[model samples]
Target: MEDTQVRDTIRSNIANKKHTSDKVMPGFFLLMASISVLTTLGIVIILVTDASKFFSAVPLKEVFSTQLAPLRETPSFGMLPLISGTLMTTLIAMLVAVPIGLAAAIFLSQFASDKLRRLLKPLMEIL
Candidate 1:
């Protein structure tokens, strides 16, 4: 029958596709993954080399100084400002994001209908 022939054709197509996937997909993925891994390893190696050179020239104690003075002949370095700035930025981001995220979660849970929540949940999750 025509239906049996169609079924045979479908099976044949799937069988051929399976062969390609079995042989090709893993090798393609491995090549792509190797490229990414090698790139990251190279970057890390370069950073470590540069950092070692810098630390050897500048003593670790100076880098951790509490006071900064760029006016003098030998300028003082204080890393406290950098650390404080990082803390401040984190605090500000949390202050803004936490309330907004909490409000969105509350709104989704309490106010939104199931259908609306279903639509919005995925969109919010993407964000």
Candidate 2:
């Protein structure tokens, strides 16, 4: 009878703990999600503030113009060349990465076992 009482007490304690955890888990997850959202909002606010300051100092026309003359009093802020360079880089990166990624997907789908595919898929996503 004493052993049964002890077991019941232990079971009640575990049940209470599990119930408490179940109640708190959603609140904990909400707090974490709120923190992430606030952090993202803060970063976006900072970026917009800084961009506004920059645009205020530099005219919008100059940013889009394509007259880049170095060794001058005020360097030209032509964004065309930079934008083109960025686009080219993105194109090259996609050209290189897409084929390999597709090949990996095909191999995973067609050749790899279910367990190996599951493991490698997550590993590739992490990488």
Candidate 3:
């Protein structure tokens, strides 16, 4: 009887409890979602409009040229140098990181206990 009365009282208290968050959070989330959608649409519209303007005046070949400077006097727009530099950096980083990451993964997967693996997996990902 005491247990039944306690449970009923707790249930009534929970049923009556109301938070500001319960009222405001749904509307806040909806507003944020709409803003994100509007922002994406606006960016796509702007990019298409400006891309059409740029491509009308410039040839696609010059934009993708492998040579950094195609002409002596003309201003260069070639992206090969930037692309190559980025690729080189990525290669160097991978060369340094891949072996270490693979060794750690092998240790975690092959040897670590289930509890340790579960705990470390998220920590390693964060690092």
TM-score, every prediction: 0.78, 0.72, 0.66
lDDT of 3 by residue, 1-127 (tens): 9999999999877766656558788899999999999999999999999999978876888878876674768755678788989999999999999999999999999999999999999999997
The candidate, 1 or 2, that scores higher on TM-score is: 1
Best by the TM-score measure? 1
Alpha-carbon local distance difference test for all models: 0.93, 0.93, 0.88
Q: Candidate 2, clashing residue pairs? A: none
**What TM-score does model 2 achieve against the real structure?**
0.72
* Native-referenced Cα lDDT, model 2: 0.93
For candidate 1, the clash count comes to: 0
Model 3 misplaced stretches (Cα beyond 4 Å) = 1-23, 69-73, 113-119
lDDT, candidate 2, at 98: 96
Task: TM-score for candidate 1, please give it.
Answer: 0.78
